[model samples]
Target: MKGITLLAVSVFSTAFLSFTPLNKKYIIIDAGHGGSDAGAVYGQFSEKDISLNIAKEIHKINKSQDKYEVILTRDADISSSLPDRTILINNLNPEMVISLHVNKSPEKETPKHGFEVFIQNSEGSKKLADKISKKFSAQTIVERNLHILRETKAPAVLVELGFINNTQDRNYMTSEKGQKEIAQKFVEIINEY
Candidate 1:
């Protein structure tokens, strides 16, 4: 939206987005922030690391299933410009685009915990976001626009997995079991479309 700023400047290109064979059903899992851009950080954990771990798990769970083929914006911890990410995602024309992220807020600024699913000003995206929110027991926000949501040809949503600053969110996201469960939930949501 108006006030929502993302890491849009890209020093990387389409090469940063790993591609696979063209499939009938496709999904693009964008692991937000990487390389020097650690995103939200708490202690030894970085938002980039958590996002990537969750994205990779989602890819692994769904890739071999033959329904929705998945591709990543960045395979590992590396920076890819926002334009490049959007360009690559739009080009794929995936069934949907889900950007993985972790939220952060100042401790004194009413620190937010739990999950949030963000959608652009579109009906389909909102529906999708809502479905995912229910799946995760998260809160859904309908907003003006995000680079990934506005630029992607497919339905898009940015999932704030949880707030790193929040103790419960931080623990759940960092745990192996929690990540797998989150990945499975996404697989179910993705296959429904």
Candidate 2:
């Protein structure tokens, strides 16, 4: 009986450790737009504010796991140039980079209000993008010629959380509940990979 109990405990401990790998560390979270660059503004809500809030939430979640060394591109309300942002990401060389932003569209009726993930023009990137998009159907994931994607040395993705200009999107993105859901979903996708 004693031997059986010891074996059961060992098996459970090993299984738990396998699911949570120790090597997975260092994630870069880039909050798009800062300082003077307000990004897309809908009523009183600005894209920069939304992005920062979501990024911070993501950081908090990742920290709780104790598996990732999460770093933010910009911690305060300061403007960072495109080149500067890329440089910062490159310097960090994290295992994964996630750039967060809110979308905007001129056509009010264009029914495109969801999260989209953009990866570098590569096969591996596409695979990662597809996995994340499928998990979060709220946003469509597509590739774009983004500076951050091209400049980052690590496997990176840029996420447009939602369209600030869209009335429905704006309401959800600015709300605390909505932001928490988005952040939680994002972490799940990352963990899945």
Candidate 3:
């Protein structure tokens, strides 16, 4: 009877393992600009710093979850070329890619504000953009032939978080609370996928 019970337990364990789905959705979070490439700058704030902070936060929060696997192109202040980033992204073959950047208008105090989502000419990219844009106020989704968007193997979207030149945007992005809020929102959105 003991042997029969052991065999039954083994069979149950095999069946359970077969039915469990261990596949995690791989996602690439590319932080725009780094090192000398400060991207948009306003006063003491640099786009590179802001983007990396947010990207790291997202990665940190997502690491605790089992459904999604988050990867960042550059986790430090070092500069990484676009081609190199694209190659790594394609090699990983992630399910989705979101590039983070801060926008800057021609004028520092320009009235132009809010986020923008740029996507490639594919339905998958558009769908991803639509989902992301819906969460933010004053978001514009447009088609762009950017190298990252064009070369990536998965549905990709370049999100301009906000204008660095604008006072409201700058204040929000620079603050730690605001960064955490942005990261939390992104994590919530990612979990939906």
Candidate 4:
């Protein structure tokens, strides 16, 4: 996590927005699971690592420009509980929360591999998910009561970036080209939102 810094450090208990003097438009990027919780794993790839890599790419891209003020829930490969993440995010009062994750299939023999975006019951959340999903040609805006989507107060999205169990998805998702492309799509989504 060297050279990685938070522009705005949030305080959790009181549940309020905090901003770096330089910027006011803020967003939180949550890199799914880390540490021992490998999320969806398949042979050479782990969802935690992949999510982090993509999140880092997003951070790097945002750092270079006077875009939105971005902050990641976990900057490194460290474990952070979903509840704690929810609490932190609720307190931050960001414009949105993008929780990066990888999708998996129960049966790898016939895998459904595609980018899927999940949204809570909120209309704004659904619209955001739809916009982003459409841009990536994703599966659809899935209305799911996922932990992050359900708990966070901000207009939140839980993006199943791609399926790790699928052959084609695995190759693209784990590659530098795919990660950067996806990261760029995220930036586009945020800016356009």
Best by lDDT: 3
User: Which candidate achieves the best TM-score against the true structure?
Assistant: 4
- Cα displacement (angstroms), candidate 1, residue 148, comes to 1.2
| lDDT on C-alpha atoms for all candidate structures | 0.83, 0.78, 0.86, 0.84
Q: Mind giving the per-residue lDDT tens digits that candidate 1 earns over 9-56?
A: 222323333454444666899999999999999999999999999999
lDDT tens digits, residue span 120-152, model 4? 999879888888878889887878988999999
Q: Give model 1's TM-score versus the native structure.
A: 0.85
Looking at candidate 2, the ten consecutive residues that score lowest on lDDT are 5-14
Model 1 ranges with Cα > 4 A deviation: 1-23, 108-110
RMSD of 3: 11.7
C-alpha RMSD of each candidate structure in angstroms: 5.7, 13.1, 11.7, 4.9
The candidate 4 region of ten consecutive residues with least summed lDDT is 1-10
Each candidate's TM vs. the true structure?
Answer: 0.85, 0.81, 0.86, 0.88
Compared with the true structure, what per-residue lDDT tens digits does model 2 show for residues 144-185?
888989888888888888888877888898999998988897
